[model samples]
Target chain A: MAIVAKSLKYTKHGEPQDVLELVEQKIESPQAKQVLVKILAAPINPADINTIQGKYPVKPKFPAVAGNEFVGEVICVGDEVKSVETGQHVVPLATGLGTWTTHAVYQEDQVMAVSKNVGLAEAATITVNPCTAYRMLKDFVQLKPGDTVIQNGANSAVGQAVHQLCRAWGINSIGIVRNRPEIEELKQMLQCLGATAILTEEEIRTSDIFKTGKLKRPKLAFNCVGGKSATEVSRHLDNSGVMVTYGGMSREPVTVATGPLIFKDIAFRGFWMTRWSKENYDTPERKQMFKDLCDLMEQGKFVAPVHEMVPLDKFKDAAAAALSFKGFTGKKFILDMSK
Target chain B: MAIVAKSLKYTKHGEPQDVLELVEQKIESPQAKQVLVKILAAPINPADINTIQGKYPVKPKFPAVAGNEFVGEVICVGDEVKSVETGQHVVPLATGLGTWTTHAVYQEDQVMAVSKNVGLAEAATITVNPCTAYRMLKDFVQLKPGDTVIQNGANSAVGQAVHQLCRAWGINSIGIVRNRPEIEELKQMLQCLGATAILTEEEIRTSDIFKTGKLKRPKLAFNCVGGKSATEVSRHLDNSGVMVTYGGMSREPVTVATGPLIFKDIAFRGFWMTRWSKENYDTPERKQMFKDLCDLMEQGKFVAPVHEMVPLDKFKDAAAAALSFKGFTGKKFILDMSK
Candidate 1:
């Protein structure tokens, strides 16, 4: 039987609302080594919007479907499919799979089986931000249990993931965020998620934490927001420490003083999940990382950030909401394709 | 007979001329495992000035003698001293030994015998600048023959050493300097030392070397002049390349765009010769580095930078010249203590 799939696609690069349109395609039954998946849920990431505008490094081909990550269920499998079975939940094994469709056909190697024990929101958005957080922490400096880590964008999805992972590893974290009216509320929320301490960008420079030696200087700093915040975060790192940049929300360059670079032996590096996945797709280490994240989610030790769900037809609204900096700036918007 | 030594001493941090004084002290004969040496030559490095002004990361104790590196001739050795014979040349094995003197006593373990085949000037200025250049090239990047390196301040002492060493290693270098009145003369000098190309800072951004692919994007970049030069140099690095900072002549911070850090995966790190020597004092790697440099110098492949020799009594002039930018900016000044 043939499956009629509805997808959000763009024929040209422009604003999401102006260029994205709904299109129907006939997806045949699973080919020799293919599987048919019914996408259940997906999230609208900032990178997705950038991709639509052709501003991101990873550009899609013209007439391309939108969305990078999602959680789906296997409806049918070809005779050669041994890694996955019908009625199994899975996620894209790599990036640029275009997961915004109601139904799609994929080669068996393109999807990996995931445990259904994870919440829909957590499983749908798990492949990108959480994986990025995991790699940044694991691949950079080797932190001992008592070692301290500092990061900005404390309210970001990746930052929250870092907090939980650090907690699980018995490492201390000092999270930094911008000052807002609900700063107190955000601080309390982060503290509950296992942040050892939380401060705004302004407080970071004046705080006695670095002076009193009560908390050792951070050995690793995660920078998602650049500009002055990146500089402030990097200045507090211990000697020979490294600051890894995975995202740039401020659109500013990373600045470091000569004193730190030469005297303190500080280092700066970058991490990209898309590149990592593409380069290491066939490695056992990548599989192990996914297994570890799923295990934590199933144990309730890690939870997805605050999210609002919208049905597939309301994707334009979800995209607009994700792009807005108005009320609830920290929450993610997920499309419930099952609806 | 008691040996009377005249040494420059500083009791506090201030201008080198104001705080420095020639003090006379009695130096006794070599005791048990000790060797007495007559200081020969020491170069006036910018770091020495910084050290006197208490602006460097390494601070000396009060009432400290002035120089950090020198070449000296062994005059007398105790019964237990075996590392060097009388009339042999040696340099300090550790920093802060105060080399600006007529005579001083050192333990057998405190000095390393170097080849007299090297000239007095080359052997005297060998420990810091040459070692820094070597370490910056070897430690930060795994460069092979034909690979390209880019650096600013290509007329500085360290920069000259880099040009010679890259020549020895068969690596290509793009040397950047400021537009001086004698720019052509300076460029010819660097090219004779094996620099593949030399340009002013203003020409770096407009250069087509990176885009033409005739010269591959540099795998390693040496940044001595921070600020705009550092930014321009780093922007041209190959993917996953590193820029190692050793000095900041411009007294400005190193700034890099967020795009390169995340999208191109360029890295920035620092290299301090003092730190590396202290941390790896006992390693075979340190010994091997010295051997490599000495071998190159002995082969006439590496030569000390152009220098003007001033007797100890003319130290005031040398200090002033070393601190000036108008005349002999690229030349080093050495104190001929023996004369």
Candidate 2:
């Protein structure tokens, strides 16, 4: 019998809504050591949009499937498959798996079985954003308990993940966000999630950390929104501290005054989860990072961000929502393949 | 007999020419563990000017002497002094001992004996600029023989030192300089010192490394000129490479596009020799670096930059020339105390 798989495919690089299309394919049974996975839920990440728009460094070949990560159930396995069995939930062992689909065929080692205790949305979205946060925090500065980290984009998925991780590690965090009408609500939300202090962009500019003596100089800075926000956060970093830039939401360059680099010995570095994962593929450290996140999720210490689930056929709507700049500012759009 | 010393002194921070004054002081005999040294030659470095203007991270106390480094001869030794005999040449073991005066009293350990084979000019300036170049090249990047490094301000003192060191290590260096009337002459001068390829600022912006491919992507970049020059140099760095900023001649911030940080994993850091020396004081590695540089100088491979020797009494002229924006662009002004 022939197995039919439905997927979102893009033949060329352009705007996601302009290039992405729904397509169907016929698949034969898995070959030796291969497993057939029926995708359950996949999130539409900003990186996924950038990939479709050809702005990201890693791109798919032409006439290729579109999504990078997902949670799926093992439907069938080849005769030689042994690590995972049917009905087990798993995620792509690495990135670039074209996860926005109804089903996929992969080699036995291409997926890792995850605990079913976490919800499908959390499991599906765990590989990228959370991993990025985990690596940047753990790899850049060695933070001791009571040490502080300051970051912008505090409400972002990775930013919230940093807050939760900091709380669990007994570290303090100062979160900065843009000025908005519901600033208090946003601050309260982040505080509930364990941010020690939250401030709007304006407050940080005229901050008197030396005068009012609110917080110590942050030992580390996480910059996802480059521009004035990134600069202000960097200005507060302790001597010889490092600011890791993983994303630039402001569409502006990372601007640093020459004084800090020469006098205080501050360093600026970039961290791309894709590059880090590929360079350190299948290391025990990476495995431990995932296991830690999974355990946190299972223990109800970390919850997935607010998200809207849409059926695969409604991809255009999902793509438009992911591309929208206004509503659902902090929510992810997940493709509900089961629908 | 009273040893009367005439020295440039600054009572407060201001323009070098406006605030610096010639003051006469009576020098005392060498105390226990102390040595009296008569200054021979001292280079007026940009850092010395910055220190006078109070713009540098290190500032002097009021009523301070005006120079940081110099070469001198041991005139007498105290009872406990053992490192060097009378007439032995030496340089300061640390910064902040004013060197522009005719004589100084230092603890025996405060000076290191050096070979008279190298001229006083090279010995006077060795402790700062050459040490900076060596530390930056060694500390930031793990450069191997045959690897390539790029830098701007190719005719400056440190730049020439970098070229000589790279030649010694069998590494290639692409030098970037401004467009000048004597551009070809400057290029030839640097080439004689061992630059692989020299280009003007415009040439670097339009370099055909992407098309004609004359040079490999540099594994390291030494940026003293910040702003666009630093960014352009960083653009050509190999993936995961670093750009070490020691100075910012343009007086602008180091601006970097976000693309390289996330896509190529390029890093930006600053190097202050004072900070490094203070932090790694009395380490064997630092001693070895100094020994290696001294050997290179004695071998006649590393020569000091072109300079105009001015008498110590002509302090105003030397300070004025050091502050001048034109004429003698790459040449240092040395105080000739013996004259």
Candidate 3:
């Protein structure tokens, strides 16, 4: 039987509010080794917005659906499908899953069966930010228990994940954020999530820690907001340390002074979660990472804080609110497809 | 009895031609752990020039004795000295020994006694360049037998050491050099030293081998010239590869494009042997490195290419010639202090 479904589509690339169009489309029956999943929830991440605007590398083929992650229940399974049974909840293992629709048909290997205990809202945001934070900490350097890391954009989803993960591992972190009027409240929030020290960018830039005594330097630095924030983080890195730049929110290029690179033997590298996952990795290694993340989530050490939930029909208004940082205090706006 | 000695001293920092002076001064008896040695042979290296010009960190308080690596015979031992016996030949295990003098004093632990088979000139050049090359190859990365490394400044002392050591370990190297009139001769020389390929900088920059995919990209690129050459080498590195910048001869800063760093996950780091040895490591590691270097030298995989053996009186002329790139090829300019 043909499954008639409603999906959010955009015929042209532009701002999310201007281009989003909800339309009815015919969903085909599950092909061989495929499962038909009914979408439950998906978050509007910054990367998802970039993908919708055609700025990200893996943009959907035009006249396409727009979403990289979502949590759903398997309604039907192909004859060849055996691992994931019908009525099981699953999430895509990667980006470009086009999870904004009412239903998606993907190969069995593309989806991971999530635990029943994990809420759909939390599961929806799991594949990107948390995975990125986990991989960056684990892959870049061999860190011991007491080693420290410094990161900018500490109030963002990935930064909070890093803060919690590092805390669980007995590692320390210095979190950097822009100075806002609610700086005290932001600091308390990050501290509750296990940040060791939280500082404004201006405080770090003008700190006397570098001038007077033996400075405490981080072994690794995580940079998301590029531009001068990257430079400021680099100053607190120890000799032979590495700084990994993963995002350019300020849209300004990351720059490094030649003296530190030459004299102190600091390394500069970058990380992109989608690109890293797409490259071949050992199967056992990936499985272990997922298990660890799940364990952390079950223990309440890794929690996804949702600001608000909006029905599918309100996506345009929700997306606009997500993009605008004027009044939001936490991770913003999840789309509830069940409505 | 009054112990008196004649030593070469520089009262002020300047060009090697103007400041070096021979002065007679009374030598004090060795302290409890110090030993005096009669100088044998010391080589003038570019670093020695920098030291004499007060550019190096460990500068002597002037009327400063200025020489670095050298061979000597133990003339007197302090009461507690146990490492060396009178009439034994030894070389300093570090810089700042001031090997240009007729006699010098050092702590007993500061010298390494040499085997009878190693020549004084070979021992004189052993401590710095060869050790730098050896440590860089072994300590920084895990290189298997079939791995390949590309290096610029192929005719340099450190470069020559790297070529020979890599050959001994069954690793391949592509050597790059500036264009010279005797380019063929230089190529033949490096080939005899076991370089798999040698290319002029211009050839490497514009070669069809890189563009047409005829040659494999190197996993490691060793850069000495830090301008466009380093960036060009970075372009030819494999994904997740490293480019180590150890020198900047062109005086132009190393510039890296953001795309490769962001997309490919390439790493850029620097190596300064002196700073690394002095600040980061301890005495036992230094001894182990020296022992390994001596073993390589004994196996004939490491050779100190001496350009000329000039007497101490001709130091000015030799220094002038050593500073210029016009003539005299390969490693050291030996100063025979005994003359």
Candidate 4:
């Protein structure tokens, strides 16, 4: 049987508001080794908007459904389906799967089963930001309990996740953010979320945190805002530390001094969740990472970033909020498809 | 007994030419586990000049004998010395030992014995540039025969060494040089030394070498000139490749785009010969590297960069030439201290 479901679709690449349209998408019954999924919630990530604007590196087919991440319920399974059963929660193993539709039929292997013990919004957002934060911390320099991590865009979803995970894992983190009018409020929020310290990017370069012995110097730095901000974060890195750049919200390139490179031997690297997902799709490490993250979430040691939940009919409002976001600020917008 | 020998000395840090002067100093006879060495030849490397200017990180003591690298002949050994015999050639095992002096007493372990079959200039320069090039090639990536390497500052001594070694190892190389009036000459020289292709920094960004299938894209990029030059060299790297920054001749910080770091998973790393020496001083890797480099030199597979060999008395002119060196151009200036 074929089922009609509401979906956010775009036939041309342009501004999300200009091109994205809500249309009825007819989804067919699951084929052998396929499962029909009912998307429970999906977040309007920046990549989603970038995909619509045609400014992103990934070029999906035209007349594409929008969204790259979602939490869905397996509603039906084909005769030969064995990996997932009806009523189980799942997350897409691969990225760029057109996740905005109310329902989708995926190959049994394309989805990874997830526990329903976590919050709907938290589950919806796990596959990208948290995974990125998790991998950056684990795969780069090994972080011991006493070691510190410094990162710009500390209020970003990934940064928030890093703080929570660091706390859960007994590691210390100093979050660097731009000085803003609500700086104190932001600082308090991050502190509550387990950040050991929060400072402006300027303060990080000449902070008393390490000088005053309040915190150890960082061995890993996360850079999302490039330019001087990236340099400042890297400047605070300990000898032989690594600076991993995952985003360039400032649209500036990363700049590094020649002195440290030659003398201290630091490294600059990058991470993209889409690429990581594809590369590690069948790896045991990926399964263990998700398992660990979910365990943290179930224990309430990890929670979704501060976000606003909207019913699917108000996706335009969510897209507007995403576009209106200024420099890693604002709450994430997640659509509740069941509404 | 004591030996009186002349050396280039600096009482304080300032302009290399202003602060440096040739002075005759007395060297005491070898103590227990020490050897009296007569300096043979040493090059006025950029690091040596920077140290004199106080711009470099490593600070030698005041009234310091200038020069960090040299090839010397062991003249006498104390009773307990076992590392080297009298008349054996040796190079400093550590940087900042002040190698410009004609005669000095060194601890037996402070120097590593070297074969004297290679040319004086080649051996003199080997402890730094060739070692740097060799390590950058072998340490970072596991490049094999037919693998390609891309590097900026192709005319640099290290760049020249990379070209020769790549050829000897059956690896192809593309050397990126700035567009100068002598561009064709520079290109021809690099090619003659076994560079598969020589492209200008601008040409590298859009070169047909990889597009036309003339050469494989480099898995490793050697960056000496930073800023836009570093970015251009990094642009042509293959997926998961690394750009190792050794020198910043342009005095501009290395600038890298976020796209490659994420999409291609490329890396930016730094290599400092001094740091590497300290870490690997007593390791078999260090011994093997020097042996490998020396073997190549003796086999006529590797030769020193074009250089002007100045006598010890003409130290001031060599200092001037080193200071006047413009953006990776000009020949190396080596001092034949035995003169």
**Alpha carbon lDDT of each predicted model:** 0.88, 0.87, 0.79, 0.87
Ranking by TM-score: 1, 2, 4, 3
Tens-digit lDDT track of model 4 for B53-82: 888898988979989888899999999998
**Model 1 residue A80 lDDT score:** 90
Candidates, DockQ:
0.86, 0.84, 0.37, 0.81
CAPRI tier for the interface of model 1: high
Candidate 1 residue B303 C-alpha distance from true site, Å: 0.4
Q: Give the candidate number with the greatest lDDT.
A: 1
Best by DockQ: 1
Predicted structure 2: clash tally: 0
Those runs of model 1 whose alpha carbons end farther than 4 Å from true positions after fitting are A326-328, B326-328
Give the least accurate 10-residue stretch of model 4 chain B, judged by summed lDDT: B321-330
lDDT of 2 by residue, A1-339 (tens): 578999889999998889988889997799899999999999999988888888877878888889988999999999999999999999887888899889999889989999889889889989888898889889988889888899898888888888888888888888999999999999999998889989899988887753466566787999988988898899988899999998888978899788899889999999999988888788999899989999999998887777789999999988988888522256788999865
Task: Kindly list the per-residue Cα lDDT of model 3 for residues B1-339, writing each as its tens digit.
Answer: 355666668988887778887777787778788988878888887777877887655578777787888888888889999988888889886667677877888988788788746776778788777777877787666788877788888778778888888888888888888898999999999988878888998998877555556455677888777777777777788877888877677666666555567777777887778786776445677778777777877766677864678887787788888877422246468888755
Please give the lDDT score for candidate 4: 0.87
Q: Candidate 4 — which pairs collide? A: none
Off by over 4 Å in 2: A209-214, A326-328, B209-214, B326-328
Candidate 3 pairs with clashing backbones: none
Model 3 chain A is weakest, by summed lDDT over 10 consecutive residues, at A208-217
Candidate 1: tens digits of C-alpha lDDT, residues B4-77? 99999999999878888989999999988999999999888888888998988889988899988899999999
Give per-residue CA lDDT, model 3, range A58-135, as digits (tens).
Answer: 658888888888989999999999889888889888667777788888999899888867777668878777888898
Which 10 successive residues of model 4 chain A have the least lDDT summed?
A: A321-330
Candidate 4: lDDT of A330? 34
